[model samples]
Every structure is written in structure tokens, then in C-alpha cells.
Target: MMKSIIDILIYAHDGRGLGHVSRSVAIGLAVRRLFPHLSVLLVTGCGATAELIGEGELDWIKLPSYKTKISCGKSCGDLGPSNIDDKVLGTVRAESLSDLVDVYKPKVILADHTPQGKHKELLRAVEGSTDSKWVLGVRAVVGDVDKVWSELSADTFTSRYSDILWYGDSSVTGSSELDKLSKHFQKIPFETGYVSRFKELRNIVTDVCTHKKLAGVVSIPWSGEGTSVLLEKVAEVLGGFDISEGIWKVYMNHRDPRVCGVKKSFECHPNVYLEQLGPSFLTDLANSRSAIIYGGYNSLTDVMGAGVPSVVLLRGMKDGEQEEHAAILSKSSSAIVNVFPEDEVTVEALRNSLEKCLKTKVEPSNMVLNGAANAARYLAELAGVRDANG
Candidate 1:
């Protein structure tokens, strides 16, 4: 008789960014592929993220959306609505998650990034489950360590959590930083490379017949206030640079219909095209001559992996991880140009950066990792679905 594999539940606090949802879905898909018989559940806060994942082999539970922010440049935490009380919001989050936990009865719960999802009720559910395993899935990059440590320390769920899984390459953080953190808790630090949901579909390249040069402008999903200001600045710079001769494609990852108005304002130029978000998003990226983008680890990695040079606009007053990431990549002889939030992203500055990138032939191959397969393998091992050793 065949044995049944344990079920796994992956939690994602999507809120306003695509990074959490995108990474979580990749893990779910990988786990499913590795253990076809294993049951997988994806709990997400973003409806767009759920829709993006669709009704695939894995089951999904959509949680009520919550707003999050980086406090004091070091920690990420939830913010209460202006009119609503903290207790009210917390109650709502907890109740919604508690109901789902009772209905699903997941065997193992894997949380991505956020610790207080479902208003900390999800943690209680997992702790109450006698047979369930609990794991926290974290990315290679994180906000201020001090703030995160304080937040985690204060939460009751931190002690009850089973293991901490670092999703990116461990080498990036160095031995000293890892040692300091490891002293505090049982850290199951594993580098499954970068969790990317990039599918290599038919490569369809769009032809540009114009004699002028074209550049691609990619923006983070409309959530951060700084990102919006940056977009406007980019538009202003492009307009001044006679960029109309060249095409500019404003790329949005959320694919939210509400963004249409914003895209029209930023990308609606004689030479600009507003491309909505979709699975084929990266394909368009691959075909672009150059890219200007916000600093998200996965997206930045993908752009570099494609061997395309980029101008990384570091979101100011945000998490320092992105700046650190860009800084690390920048050491490679113009692999990436790091621009601060306060820096004027003028047309001349952008034009100069693009020119330098076009002239330089630095190949950023060292950063690329065979992440998807490794991540899948890791999930398989965790689920105890791997074949017996010889």
C-alpha cells in the first residue's frame, strides 16, 4: 500500500507588494511538482495575487488585506486604519484566519515574511495542531534587523514557530551576521536560491521600427508613496530627453485595473506603451534594450539574469535591503547603477547610465543561481517525499 504524504500550507502576506505573493506561489508550484501527491494550500492577503496564481493544483484561501510599512528604516509592521481602532482590525484579522484554520486543518504551515498574518491567529492555530509542522520562510533580504528582532521577540508566535527557512543564498549574508542571529534561535538557514515564478514560454519579441532608441521603465506596484513620486520624476526626465523618439514601456506587476489611470499619466506618450501585468511580463522585459526599475530582490535578480543592464531606483526611506542588494551588484564594474530616492533622476543622468551600460560588457553571471529546481528539492525533502537513499 502506498503511503500518504503530509499536507503543507504556505502563508503569504501580500498586502501591496507582488514579491511576497510571487515568491510564495513559486514555492507552492515547486512543492507540487516535486510531490505530486502532496496537498498544498496557499493563504494570501492580496486578491490579485490569488488570481495570478489561479486555481492550479494547489488550494487557496484569501485573507483580508492588511496594510504594512517599514518603521524607522529597520522593521516592518502593520498600521491601523485612520478611522478604525487597532483592536478592531486585529479582531477582524484573527477571526478570519481562525475560521480558515478550523476548516483546512493543515498539517504544516509555512509563513512568508509576515509574522502577524491573520492577526496572529494563524500562529495560534498552528500551535494548537498536534501533528502540524510550522516553518517561517524568509527571503535573503530583510528590513532593519533591530526592528525585526524587536517585533519577532514581542510576538508569542516567534517562540512557537518551528524553523526559519532563508530562501535566498546564505553566502550573501556572510558568516558573522548568520552567527549572531543563530545564537538567538534554531535557524534552519537554507539557500534555495531566488524564488522566481518565471516560466520560459514562447519568446515573442516586439519589433520597434522607429529610428530612435527605446528604453523600458519598470515600476513597483503602486503601494509605496515614494515609488509614485519616482515614477513622476522618471516621466519628467524622459520627456526632457527627447525620449519620445524612443519607446518607453511602463510595466506594472499588480495588473490591477485601477492602475490604468496612473499608467496613462506616466506611460502615455507618443512613443510609450502601457503594458498590463501578465505571465508574459518577463518576456517583454527580455526583449527590452534597457530597463529602469525599483529595487525588489527577485525582480532585480531576474533582470540581471536576463543579461540586461538596469538603472536601479532605490526606494528611499524604505527597507535598506534593496539598496544593499543594488550596492552589492554595483561592485561588478557597472553591472547596475544605484540611484538614491533624493537624487534627481534627470534625463541626463539616466541617458548617461544607459550609455555606460551599452558600452560596458560586464556579464553578471555569478549572481544567477539554479533556484527553482533547488527550491523544489528542498520542499520535497521537508515533506519527506524524497526517494530513499542508495
Candidate 2:
């Protein structure tokens, strides 16, 4: 028998972008920090893991890449990204994963989002391997309720899992969504609220001073892969607003760096203040009058976590994840507004949404910022590792 050598193993698959991989890294970091002695391993598809997470801090396995396509779960779109043919790469990936689970024998397995993984790759391995307890971690809002509910109802493994973790706040997801999930799992999964990787603004005093300087500056952070049109339209429409210093603040990130190329930058008539990719974005999000962001898991969490007034625009594709999250954001707090029709997002709608976002209410509870640590603690408990920090 291959003995247990790893404490926890995470499968972070991504066909589209970085949200799943990012959250998985945050969890792994939290688990490693919370329980320093136990080794943590993450199996991820995002190539940027090394860039986001420091190398060698945790054991890692990178699967071959696959491009992700956005499809409305209930619609007639093509099924997501193509997988490596099972005969060759798929067989190796599956066998390699199964071998790892069998040989390393991790004490816990945390699967983010999908229970089966891309193309059901982890199904056999997860079911047949080790004495390892299984955990399914889901965000508060996962696309459309009907779509997500239907998918869950059809899944055999979700009902059989040892632990299911919901990383969004209970209030945001509400009883209706919870009730829907409870039917499939037969038990309500643990709700950890919204998880944030932030710890206050770097320096509240200095940050306040910066925000005062850019009194009219609005922050726009977006997923590079999907929101090119929305980004361009917003940039074009900034002409209507009175930018405080003739400088607009936009964040630079991996998926989309130059949101508007230099040509569009000049056309906007304001010196576009693009924050470098590496600087912590929370401070920028905090300093802005408001943020206009895509409704991806991390973006919503960050916006809500920072307690920033903002507008949530949804791609609503690929299972309606962002669409679901945007709806929840609207329901939970007045500060975050969801603007629809991402394809035709206009200056007027954005202007109207941003105005409302600026005056929206604070989070009804602290659940918005509670996810990362709570998840870490739960993972530790599942491993049966005594909480030495207590």
C-alpha cells in the first residue's frame, strides 16, 4: 500500500480563466499557514500559479493546458473547452492523478467548483483512492440557480462526499439557494462567508490620503479573457465624466494588461493611471470612489471584502456563475449593483449603476471577509490536525 505522505491535495482546474486557481492558492496558503507542519499539494491548470504563488512553498502538479469557452449552461452554446483526447493525454492525466492519490494518500482532498473535474478526470481517482476524506468547496454564487441545481442533482459524487464547503456568506446566498443545495447534498454544506486575501488597506491613514487625492477616480478591474468589449466601452464613455486630475485609475492584471491600448488611452483624454500587475489591488479598490468589475468569484469577493461601492457586470456564461454572483451581490448589499447585458454595457447604464453603487449600504454582516481563514480552519479540522494556534 502506498502510505499517506501528503496532508491535503487540491484540484484547481480552469478551462477559462484564473478565479478557480486563485482561490485554490489562497486556500492552500491559508492551510499551510494555519497548519505549518503538514505538506499541502495543489494540482492546477492555471499556468500562472508560480507567478501568483511563490515557488516551492507548496508541492504542485500542473496539468496540460486546455482553452475554456463560455457557454450558457441552459442554452445551445457548444460545451466548454475541448479536453485532451482521453486516449492519450487524458489517460495519462487520469492515471497520473490516480497514482498520486493512491501513492501519496493525502488525508484530505478539496475539489474547487466541479466535483468531477474537467471531463470527469478526477472521478475515478477521487472515488477509489485512499482513506482520504473528500471535500467539495463552492463559492457563494455559482451562475444560475436552475443550472447549478440541475448539475448538482445529476452528480453522484456530491451527495456521497464527506464534507462540502460553501465559501460564500449565508446571507448573500440566502435560504432559497441553500434549500436548493440541501436537497442534493442531504445536508447543508459549511458556509464560510466571503473569503478575502486582504487585511485592511495597507495603511489606512495613507490610503485615505490617496483616495482624497483622486477624489473622482473610479477603479475598473476586469477579467482580461472575456470583458474586452465592456472594458473598451467603459473607457470610451469616461469622456462624459469629470475625471478629477485628468487621470483615471485602471488596474493591470494577467488576463488583460492594457485594458485600452495606447490609442484608446489617448482618445480618453485622461492620463490613464494603470497600476502595475504586482501591487496589492485592495488598496486601489479601497481608494477608488467605486469599482466597475466583472462578477467573477474573486472580483466580487474583493469588491465586497473591501466594502467598496461598485457595479457588477456579468459575463453570465459558462454556467452562469457570474450572473448568479451578480444577483446575490445585488440582493445582499446596496453598495454593489449588477448591470446586465455585458455585451452591450453602455456609458449611461454604467454611469447610473456607479452612482447607485456609490451610495449603497455596507455589508449586512462580516461574512464578506470571512472566507479564507474559515476555509483554512475547516481544512485543518478535516485533516484531524490539532489546531496548535488555539
Candidate 3:
């Protein structure tokens, strides 16, 4: 039997935040809408990928997953309790990706964030598929400059990508970092200006700040060892506000096994309410009086694009991307306040920031927010789909 041809294949090795998978799904949905005749397949390692895809919107494949963490100043993989060797799992993911390429023979393949995919698994597949146009989709701030340039300068992987898509604006906070990358790479990438579900968040919302008196918004969808502590601090700080003020809304990932413990330990404040992370997260953020968010790309995109005054808690990852992003944005925008590690969070500081945020006047941002549609159009053109429409 013959395998069906796939018009577009998108791969996102997302094991942490919803950024990669969210961006991938947004582009896939946009492509499907713009070119109804085309078939789109999203291949990702995130278990939540399925939840993000709307019914009959796009086909998806979920691969075995592994999480990356920082330990002893070096990045390492956590395979959970599985006895399978880390290398063996890597091989399995690699082979699975290669098999999809060999069988489906997609006209175009898009690899998100990591150019060569997680553990360099997608490199072999890209090298073997001579007929497909393999593209790389990058976020606004990709950690260290030297490290990123060193990785992209490699001929083996750099030569394999036919096009590069940047999901950020050069005019934003991290423009200088992006400038360094462009100068080093010597190739101007197509700027998509912060890929988001703009039609879903920025454009469609006529009711801005429906919760004007609402204290703030907090979202930590991926739980960890310190998740409970963070939640406590949020409650403590928000609860400190006058009771007459509206409630503090928090969004969490109930699906994470660790979250149950976090929920149980949570001493819910009378003014704080917890809700599971859902499609309404961005919309809620847009309508919020203020937001307390981690320093992730999508979080920054939503907060900045919505012009919501926010307090960004830097994650201090090994790559220093989040810290770097928060630092840059702190310098560029007064609407944002940067706080350090979760272990040192002080209620006074958070309260002050929240107060400042509430007082600040923020107009909806004028930045380009139609990156998903822009990316879809570019991908369609790259695939030579002339009949594609807006």
C-alpha cells in the first residue's frame, strides 16, 4: 500500500512550556485555513500537542518524550523511571522521525526552535530527504549568542535548512540580540513578528479589561518541584491586596502528576482562585488588570502584544534565555517588572510591582501580531502552492 502525501510536516520537540507546540499548532491551523486543499501534519514530542489541535483542524503525531533539565551547570535529560538508556530513546525518536519522512514524503518540513531537532534527531532525516524543503522556525531570543551562532554555523545542519523563519520582531526588546545573530549568520531570515493566535487573542477581543478590578493573572502550566512555592507566593501577594479588589486568577496544568500535590499543599487565599490551563488563557490575560508570568517566549509575546502590565519572574535556565529576555524587556519597557529566582521571591516586592502595574496606563500594542498568518503564507509560497488564499 502507498502512503498518503503530506503537504506540510511540522516538528516541535517541546517537553516544557507550551511555546513550541503552541507556535507549531498556530502555523498549522493558519495554513489549513489559507489553503483548504492542503494536508498538514504536526509531529511533536509534547503530550499536550493533541489538546491544542482543534478537531479535524490538522493531523498530529505524538512521539515518546524526554525532559531536559539543568544539573551541575550542565544540561541533562530526565527519562523518569524508565530503564531505557537515554541514547536508546534518542535513537527511537530519530528513527520515528526518519520513518515519517520516508513514508509520507512531505513537500515541506518545518523544524521548530532547535534547528536540528532535539538531540540532533531530525538531522539525519533532513539529510536523507533531498526532495523536501526543510525549514527552521526560531523564537525571538534563543539564549546565548555565541552558542547559538556556533550551532547554526555548522555546515551539516545549516546547509540542510532551505529557509529560516523568525517568530519575533526586530523592533522588540531583544532586537540587539537578533541583530547579532543576523550579522553572524550572514543570511536574513523571514521575520514573522511573534507567531501567535492573533485572531484568537489580539484581534477578536472587543471587551478589553472586562476584569479591570481583577488583581492579576498567573500562569504556570508546567509544574515542577517549586511549583507549589510559586503558587503560595502568588496567593500571598495577591491576597495582600484589599479584599474589595477582585480575585487573583491562576492557571495551572492539572494534568501534570506533580500538580495534585501542589494543589493539596496550596493554602488557597480567600481572594485567590485556581483554574486549569485552557484555551482562554491568553484571552484572560488580555482582559487582566495585570499579570505575573514566567519569562518564556510565548508568555512575553502574549503579555507584550496585549500590552498588559506584568511582573516577569526569570526562570534562570542553563541557556540564560529567560533571564536574558526578562533583562532586555525590563530595560526596554516600563510596563514590565523583572524579578529573580523563585526561591527568593519577597511579598513586598511582588506587591509593589503589582501596585505599580495597576497604576500604569497601557494601550493595546501596535506590534505586528499576525505572525501565524504571515508564516502560513510564506510556507505556502515555499511549497509552491500558488492557489493559497488569506
Candidate 4:
């Protein structure tokens, strides 16, 4: 007898950072690993993310990419009320998404954070679909609860849709916030843990200081957002240091290079090396003296897993969720200088922070790394598949 196939739709909102898209990819990979026969469709709106998701084990659909504006978890960049054009774009994106659902007819629809398309139309489409299990894939730290609740409550989307809200972070890491949100929504609230999708390169040295040479790996996207400014500041500060004595490796992972134009001269430094994106991002983190990073949960988790101390730069204009994550990691002695980009993000401050982080000893927190795989296993169970370890 032929085995039954499970079709899954993974929707990623591409309005802000690449976190949602990356996490969705990781989930799809996890699901595929659990059930080899499962057909996974990844629907995203980022061109760069689409490139990263090229010709994989899963099918792909690209929607209209929108600029993400995160203010206390209420996205307003391209999807919110701020943009006049997003109204048309949102409708178009929603119609395309609905069309995909209609044609593919997935057994399960997994929406990451926000529902795709317009509020009313998307809900209607999902509701009218035939026997589809709707799951809300949420990260551990969403944002300020009051702000998110107020925004979501006012929106028609929240009132019409219901889902099995699956959290992608450990309860230990996000218990406080998740507990608060649980009061309002009927959520399943399973801990999917922190999914670090970087390939575990074999023969790779897990130790950062193993290599005699000292290098700095700065991983941030080249967007005009606060992260880019932080990256430039770090480069400026690091340039003042005597790099002739040690290697300085800076790795940026975004399409736009103009954002880093201020430090264009550093690209030519004998000791300083610049790369657009590293396929082995985690490996580089493992090999570097320290990393300068924006506050994204995946990068933070990976650095912590590698036991590398880092300087976390929080986006100034966005919600304080990243700052919250940075604080937790810092409390565990895993990070240094958790501050907003606009406040005291100067060259002197960055240099001082980097010096401290490089000298500081950060013990890897197995709490998150171990929990991630277990979370994947739990998700498998939810999908009615037997756990491989079980």
C-alpha cells in the first residue's frame, strides 16, 4: 500500500528582517526530515530569501516583497496602515496566496506570526478551504504584549481567525511573555525551541579561540535599519585598532552594500576581510574572536550555542523585543553591550564593548540548543508522525 502524503504550506511574512523567512525554512526542513514523503510548500515575499531557498526539497512561491516596520510588534512598513500602496500590494499578495491554497489544497497551513493576505479575505479563504489544519508558528519573543494585543485586537484579522499557536522557542526562554499572551488566545503553545538552521559543518572546530589568529566576524544585514548603522560603527571602531597585529574578518549578509559605504575603505585593509554572506555563518562565529551582531534570535542562539561572546545592537525604531532577548542572553554572560542603535552607539562605546566581550567568558547554554531538536520532534508528533528517536 502506498503511504499517505502530508502537504504543508509554510507562510513567511517578509516585511521586516529575514528572521521569519529563515525560521520558516528551518521548520520546513525539520518537517521534511521527519516525514520524507511530506510535500512542503514555502511561500515567501523576500527575493533574497527566495534565493537562499533556491530549488530545495520543498516547493516555493514568491509573493510581493514588502518593507517591514516593527514598532512594538505592530508591523507598519509595507503591510500596515502607514503605506498607501501596501493596500493594493496586500490585496494582490493575498489573492496570490489564496490561489496557491486553492490549487495546492494543503492539509495543513502553517502561518508564521501574521496571516497572509488581507485580514478578511485571508480568513475567508482559509475558512472556506477543505479540512485544513491551521497552525500559527510564533517565535519565542514576539514583542510587548500590550502593544501587540491592542494592535491585533483592533485589526479584523484577530477576531476572525483561530489557530493552534505553535511557539518556536522554549518555555524556559519565553515563559513570561507566552503566559501573558495565553490569557487572550486559545493557543497550543508548544515549544519548538530556537531553530538554528546553519549546517553543522563536520571537521569544523567548535572552539572560537582554537585558531591562533584573531579575527572579528560582524554579521548584520545591509539595510538602512539600525543594524546597518551599528555594523558601520563597529567597523569604524575596529579600524582604529592595530589590525596589523591580528586578522579582522567582517561578514555581512544582505543584498545592499551601500548601507556599509561609510566603511568602504576598510574593505581594503590588509588585516581586514569583508564578505557579503558566509555559507558557514555559524562556523565563522565558532572561529572568530568575537562577533558584532544585530539582535536576531537565530544569530543570538547560534552564538550562544557556540559559546562566543557578542556585542548585540538593538534596532532603535522597532519594538523592544530584541533588547529583551539581548538582556536575557547578557544575564547568562553570553553577550555584551545590549543597547539601542541611536543611543551611545558611537565608535568609542563599540570598541569598549567589543574589547569586553572578547575578554569575557561565555559558557554555552545547552538549554536552547537541546530544546530545539526536541521541539522539532514535538512538531512531528503534532503532524501525526512518529519521532525518530522514539
Candidate 5:
């Protein structure tokens, strides 16, 4: 029997954070909704892929946990501390991708973030495959511009990728640098606004949350080893508020027990309701009076899209991506107040920032929020999938 052809195969390397996998799932879900006839498959290293994309929505291949570490400015991603060496792991993942392409024979392959994937494992898959349009999807504020320029301009990326997708608003994220780079390389990316999963996420939380409205929402998207101090400071600041009347809600992340200083049983504030992080987190935030959230691309875009006034807490990554995003958001939208220098975030500073944010009126950005759909549409076009009604 002949093997079934996959309409689209999306790959995401989630070494750094949930951003890559989240984007991939969002795009994959969008493709399913917009073009139901076409089949989509996801290949990712993130264990959270199943939870994010939901079961049975799309068939996916979970690759070996591949992570990247930059030391002395030269580092290819590898499965750290595993029994298998980096070279062996790379070869295994490369071979798996090659086999998937050979058997499934996808018409379009969408790669998120890294063009050639970690350690160039995806290069083999691309080279080994034929008649498939390979595209690269980049988010806004990709760390340093010089480093990104170097990666994008390399012969490897310039030669393989037929097109690029920019998942952000130009006015808000400042796409000029990337725009210039793409133009110089003659492979301009399709600006598809910010890819948001607000609706999808909201649906996930609705069953658990009984209330149709919430007064306020606070989200901390980080946890584990290095996050204790920051979490403590946040707890201290938020503890001062009076939530005895149940007017304020704190959506704490229970996904990891070592979620810093905030414990599930610890209630520092009166009348405050604490719950685990759910899909409803963003949905509730969108309907709340004010919000305090981590300054990630997805979080910021979702909040800004809903026109929710918010205080953005930056993790202060070494790459300065969050800081750059905060800076751009502060200038483009007046509804957000950003607290920088993650380590230096004090109770007073965070408290004052949130207070200020509460006073500001919500001013939603005018940028289109259908990036996932737009990206899916582009894939369909490339694959020659079209609506019968048209």
C-alpha cells in the first residue's frame, strides 16, 4: 500500500522555552481549523507538546530532548548529560526526520525559530526530501540583531528556505532590522502579525472556571531553580493587597511544585483566590480589570490584543529579548508598565508598577491578530490547498 502524504509537517525546537512549541501548536491548530481537509503533523522536542496541542488534534512525533547551550559563543544543541553523545543524538534525530519525510512525504514543512534546527539536524531532512516547500517562522525580538543576521544570512538558511514568516506586529515589535535583512537576502518574510492562542487557551480553561468574570489576574510564567527570589518578591508585594472580599484572583503555576516561594497552601493576602495555571489564565486576564503578567511574546501579545491594561514583568534573559520587547511595548502601547532587571525587582517597584498600570486605560493595538490563520493560509497556498467555496 502507498503511504499517505502529510499535508504539512511542523517542527519546533523547544530547548529554550515554551515559545517554540507554543507557536508550532498554534499554527498547527490554525491549519486544522482553516483547512480541515489538509492533514498536519508536528515534530517537537518539547514534552508539553501533547498538553499544548491537545490529544488527537494532530499526530506528532516527539523527538529526543535536544537542548542548546552557548559557551564561548559557539554551541550546537545537544541532549545534555544523556547517555548518548551529542553527535549520536544529532544523527538519531536527523535519521528520524529523514525517515518521516521519506515515508510521509509532506508537501510543506514549516520550521519554527532555527532555520536548520538544532545542530543542523533538520538540514539532513530538508536535503533528503524533494518537492516540499520549506519555510522558516521567526518571532519578534529574536535576541541580538547581529547574531540573528549572521544565522539568517548564512548560505545554509539562504539556500534552503523558500520563504519566511514574521509572527509579530511591525509597529509593536520593530521588524525593521529583520525586514532589511530579508530584503538584502531577497527572501522577505510574510508579516503575519502576532500569533496568539487566546481563544484556544480560553477554551481549555472554561470547564474548570465557573465564573464568567474576574476582577484581576496575575500570572508568573517561570519556576524552578533560579526563580525563588523573584517569586518571593512578587509574593511579598501582592501579599499587601486585601483580597478578603474575593475581588482579586491569583493564578499561580502549580505545574512545577518548586514554583519558588509561593506555596499552594500559603495565602498571604485576604480574600484572594489562588488557582493553578490553566488555559483560562489568559481568558480571565482578557476580561479582568487589570493584569500582572510575565513579559513573554505570547503573553504580551495576548494581553495587548485584548486591550487589557497590564504590568509586564521581565525575566531579564541574557539575550535582552524581553527587555527589547518591553521597551517596544512601552512605547507603542500606553497600557503597559514594564519592570526590568529581574533580579532587582523589589516589592515597592513591582507594587508601584502594577498600581500605575491599573490607572492607565486599556488601549489595544490595532495590529491584526490572525497570524496563525495567515500563516496557515500561506502554507495552504504553497501546498495548493484551497477552499471549494471560493
Candidate 6:
């Protein structure tokens, strides 16, 4: 690591789910790995950032956060969309961003999801930066583009950002929302197949003995940052399972088992071996006989990378990004079984998938999971950075 030539500031407005924050973390990790001299600063509202991003990194700024109204129907936990005023909130966030920009003087500013942020704050904050590269990172499907266009308008698209970074595969499939925004796209888009933190597994496809070794893993899926609407439902369905004979580990992400089932404590859940999240919890999923997990961006790649035969959950609704990813991955390989909620949750599919994953030995797919590294190297190029040798 030589003299620091650039500093990268990533603004991840986690008004939605951990998806945006997680994706940004993957990119930041990649950036730090590629440009060891470049310091990465991430600004986020996700409460789990401190716990997930590691301590003493001294790289994150926590902000007063709010969650999307769509995700949280009635119960607005702590802070929700109804609790916020766009005008006042925007002004407050803009001031904080502007102050940070003046001091940090970032060489590259990457704004995830919204260019205007939760309330048009990013547009107002980066007004005076003459040397910084402004970039907008977007997912494949970002909801009704017409609604987005009406909210942001055509005027907001011109000269607001330097590049459009798309983190989805353009050839195999496409995002309807991104397709609609294509006419407004001006700059060259840097598209990555998908941004995943883990590299694709090589040759560790040994089968987990199900009958011989009685063990399983369950995780409640979350759709947004503030609350786990999906988790609450899944937990209830899982509570009825009679797995007392086997050891079951559950990652109750945002759901309380008491609210759903799990009458006993973690220590007394009889069959449930573990139900708490830890620093290296994914390792447990990677080493499981079979597992049930969410279909989020990172979760999909991480489990697939782990080469564990698993069951993926879907909300079975429109504008759900995970559904598409689940469809693609499930089709690409037979390692994962996709399950959806019908009328209510169809847990039978989960049970069947678990039985199949546990009893069978499947070959590992050769799909590449190097998107994080690719994104890191590409962002370095976007910053127009060159090493001393170059």
C-alpha cells in the first residue's frame, strides 16, 4: 500500500432491505482488496452495519434511518415512511452529506439505488464537487420505472451522475424496470453479472449424510430494512415442524421465535441446535446437511457458492427481485429447490426439498461467483486510477 491516491465514498440508502447495504459492502470489500491504498467510507442507515461490517474498520457513518411503507404495512417499527417528511428529512440528510463531502473530499462517489437518495439528498450534497466521479449503482428491477420517472422526472436524469452500474446479467435475462429506463440512460453502463461477496466454490461437493447425520438449518427471509414481514410468516410455518429427532439451527434474522413458535429457549429447543446469528454464521449454513434460506442477492450467491443443496423462499409477488434470481438459479442448477407461498406458506415443498438435499449427492455447478472482485477492479478503472508501475 503506497500513498493513498483516492478515497471512495459509498452512500447506501437502506430504505429498502439489507440488499443495498449488503451489495455496497461487497463492493467496498472488493475495492479495499484491489486498491489496498484506497480507503473506503460507507454511509448507511442499516442498523446491522456495525455488527456485519466488522469493528475498528472506522469506515461507516450511521444515519437516522427510515423503512419503506410497502414493506411495513401497518406496524412501523421505530422509524417508518409515515414518520418522515421528505422535505425536512431531505434537507437534514443533505447537510450531513455535504459536511462529510467537504471533509472527506472523495475521489469517487458511488450512490446506491436512488440518485437523489431517500429524499433527493445526494443530488443536493454533491453539487460543489468539481473533481469527484459521480456514479449511480442500480439493481436489475427497481420497481415501476414510470413511478420512478414521475417522482424524479426527466430533468433529474441529465448530468446527475457519471456512470450507471448495473449488477445483473443482461444477456440471460433482463429487468423490466431497467428496460424502461434505457431511453434515459446516457452514459455507458457498467453491468456485472451479479455482485457476490464469496467466490464460486471449486471442488468441495461432498454430500451431507441426512439419515446418518440428523441436522438441518432454517433462516427467516426479510424483504426490507426495518421489519421482517416475510420472516414473521416463515417463522410461524416453521414452528409447526416436528424436528425433535434432528438438530435444527435457525437464523431468526429479524423474527422472534416466541412470536411465531419455538416455545422453548434456544438451549431448550430440543431439536433446534442453534437459533442465533454470529460473526461466521454463514459457515454453519455452508456446512449444513440441508438449509432453507431467503432469495436475496447475497444469500442466493453465498448458499450457491457454498454448494449446499437448499430450499429458497419467495414472497410470490410482483416487484420481488428475489423471485427472478431464484428462478434463474433454480433453473441453472438442480442443487437448489425453489419454494413459494401458496394461499399460505407451502412448507411441504421445503420438507420435500430438505429430504432430497439430505438424501442425495449433487455435483457442484461451475457457475462463476467472482462478481465482487470484478466490481472492485471495474470501480478502480471508473475512478481512472493507475498504480505507480502504470
lDDT of 2 by residue, 286-315 (tens): 665567766677777766666677776666
**Comparing 3 and 5 by TM-score, which wins?**
3
Instruction: Give lDDT per model, in order.
Output: 0.58, 0.63, 0.73, 0.60, 0.70, 0.61
lDDT of 5 by residue, 271-379 (tens): 4567665555655676676677777777777676666677777665566777887788778776576646656677788877766766667665576677877888889
- Structural similarity to truth (TM-score) of each candidate: 0.79, 0.79, 0.87, 0.81, 0.84, 0.78
Which regions in candidate 1 have their CA more than 4 angstroms from the true location? Answer: 1-6, 50-58, 68-87, 114-119, 145-147, 151-159, 199-214, 239-246, 253-268, 332-335, 342-344, 358-364, 388-390
Candidate with maximal lDDT: 3
Off by over 4 Å in 6: 1-6, 55-58, 69-87, 143-154, 174-181, 200-214, 221-246, 254-268, 316-318, 360-362, 387-390
| Residue pairs in clash, model 5 | 243-270, 243-271, 244-270, 244-271
Q: Runs in model 5 with CA error above 4 Å? A: 1-4, 54-56, 67-88, 145-147, 151-153, 199-215, 224-226, 244-276, 387-390
Tens digit of per-residue lDDT, candidate 3, span 249-331? 88888766766665643445677777878766765776777888887777776777667788887655667787776776666
Candidate 3 vs candidate 6: the lDDT winner is 3
Candidate 2: residue 157 Cα off by (Å) = 2.0
Candidate 6 has an lDDT of 0.61
> Order the candidates by TM-score, highest first — what do you get?
3, 5, 4, 2, 1, 6
Q: How does model 6 score by TM-score?
A: 0.78
User: What is the overall TM-score of model 4 with all chains considered together?
Assistant: 0.81
Residue 14 of model 6 has an lDDT of 68
Q: Which residue pairs collide in model 4, if any?
A: 15-68
Work out how many backbone clashes candidate 1 has.
1
Q: Stretches of candidate 4 above 4 Å error?
A: 1-6, 50-58, 69-75, 78-84, 115-121, 145-174, 199-214, 225-232, 253-257, 333-343, 370-372, 387-389
